[model samples]
Target: MATRRKEYRFRNGKIIEIEENHDGNYGAPGQKRIKKKKPTEEQMRLVNINNKVKRCRHKLLEYFNAGDCFGTWTYSQANRPPDMKAALKDFQKTIRIVRIEYKKRNRELFWIRNIERGTKGAWHIHFVVNEIGDTASIMQKAWKKGGIYAVEIRNEPKVYDEDFSKLAAYMTKDEHTKEIKKDGTPAKPRLKETSYNTSRNMPLKKPHVDKLVRWKNEVKPRKGYYIISIHEGINPVTGFKYRRYTMVRFPEPKRKVQLKRRI
Candidate 1:
């Protein structure tokens, strides 16, 4: 017996030839199986950066509720900003020193370092740090790598009045896009490092699913925890849609004891 084959042509001028398998299934041999496309370097970079940004946002929201202050620290020089490698080195040393100094206060400091280009086309570091005492002085004193300029620390407004999403967006704006250097070279290819850095003290968020019915209902206040924000989106990795409810757990409330009266 001779097996019949069929050839199909598409509008794109492409042809697909299919033959019957031994089991009588019609396909191009193993065509019934689905193959996943591998992501390119650029695509991988974008995905990584996006995930980092999301994690940062979640952490920021959590830390802010704990009364942590937010501020920015910049590194610059008279000639130009320090190179990425040198700037990162200085940042690491600065964080180490800051931790040691703040150890006495028993407070944890969280930071995210963003590398950006200044108006003068110089590479500089724009760092966002959680509340720490005398942060400007500590960072300025630690950064001695040269081109040391003023380290400005500006307090962020109240969390309720501010849009936290902008923080992540600002840090990662145009990060995935390709840029051209003054020398007519692609800057993206040269950027082999991450766009941002975070402190090890920062906690990771574990999101839980919420009932779809509660989408429009106000979140109820619990005794030891409260809802910070709710976000709904499709998971890129798993391709599953989910509604995430972010909650901040706090210390247990102190209970009042009543003395019993004797009859």
Candidate 2:
């Protein structure tokens, strides 16, 4: 009765999340509430980054698939952005040009981007944009202030079981390093805020919620769907077992053509 499972179905794959409801009546209405220990700053930071990465990965799975562009834009020392705001402005300028190019061809561009400033003050942008032909060329022309490295999201993945998980993790990584300030004092490690920007045309995916009256441990994929990744974990709060996995259905093979009889 306390178990809830959610299924997010995407074009190429699906994600499953199972959790135990912790809203049960642990105390009576009149009982004084006991204050719980606050989570440390580092713990909170990690949780936020994890949630952002998960959300971004699901969105990637929902709208974009193989052949989409995964790109990194870096600035030269001369043209590097002076601040995070300037970096964002530069990204906007580039995307605006890209959108116009797509519009000229009677198409709309959907993109997700994350910008980060390194500890050494180097600013860069990581983006995943839907490719509708001429994507790489368009990117190269649009972002003139920096070096652009764009590659198609491969249909076959060498590291992860699925295609986009590794890419998503790499793009949303919260890289940080310790450093000493010019004043001979320790400085806060620059943490890449786990956030992303999206084009207005991006789709908001909603998952189907299922309440499992009878819990089943066995997971079986539907016909034509193959399980690619499986993860099992226990909730520290409830001590309940929860598990999730992804199922991907490959494109069906094309039917062979037959030659007409000579007679």
Candidate 3:
């Protein structure tokens, strides 16, 4: 943090401008400065683990949203390169029965995939094709009979509120924060590290270089924790003002890129 000293450089008394050093945002921090509280050793380890799990979870969710019946089956061939065409072929074969069954019985159920980086050095799925059936044995037999080892039978564990507990376990369980020395109650909402854009600081209303550009092009800026550029929530539904700054579940890059040189 450099001090802004009022020193006059007089060639003539017109006006000379000087920028404060470092500006508190950019540049490397040397040993003299400490930015934030140093977390405990345990805290750092847990944070690293959580970040990995979160990344894996994103891929898992992507598979489901792309018309996957159960999150259990992976598009990637067990540690081998993904054969999407083969996966889709298998998908078509599996769902043809499902679609036929649906028409006859109207099963509008969605599947939930329980995935983990397996001990066998392959990503595995404990696929429950749909939650609305006792079809575990049926599906397992079908896959084996049709030669798809990737589709396996791993049902919900025998625990109270089986499905709910699993989801809560993932969502609620987070890394421990720095242990406060004195008595400090854990806050209501858990803390999670998020991708923070450097454009987190809001621009003051003096026609800042950023705001002028945003206004001219009429692009929306996102909200919350901006240091440089601005953000406005652009909801296709009720619109930005009615919405809240969304939780950072994925990496959204800060748009502080300068394209002036390219043009």
Per-residue lDDT of model 3, residues 1-263, tens digit only: 33221212212211111112222222234545434455677666755654444333322322222122232344344433243344344544665565456555665533333333332434333343443343444344444212233222232233112112233234223323333435675544233321111111222121111111111223222343222222233322211121111121223568896667655
Clashing pairs in 2: none
**Best-to-worst TM-score order:** 2, 1, 3
Worst 10 residues of 2 by lDDT: 19-28
What total of clashing residue pairs does each candidate reach? 0, 0, 15
lDDT (Cα) of model 3: 0.32
Q: Which of candidates 2 and 3 is the stronger one according to lDDT?
A: 2
Say which candidate scores most in TM-score. 2
Which structure is stronger by TM-score: 1 or 2?
Answer: 2
lDDT of 1 by residue, 1-263 (tens): 11222222111111111212121222234466333456677667767776666666655554443334344454445534346676566667767887787776787777776665544555655556655657656666665544433332223432222325556655554434455689997675323333476777766534322222112324353455455455455534333333434344565579999999999
Residue-level lDDT of model 2, residues 43-159, one tens digit each, is: 677667656767777777777877788888889899987677778888888889999999998988889887877767777788888998899899999998879888887842531
Candidate 3 stretches with Cα past 4 Å from truth are 1-92, 114-123, 129-134, 145-163, 167-263
Model 1 regions more than 4 Å off: 1-46, 61-66, 75-79, 104-106, 118-120, 140-164, 172-174, 177-194, 203-228, 233-242, 247-263
lDDT of 3 at 213: 11
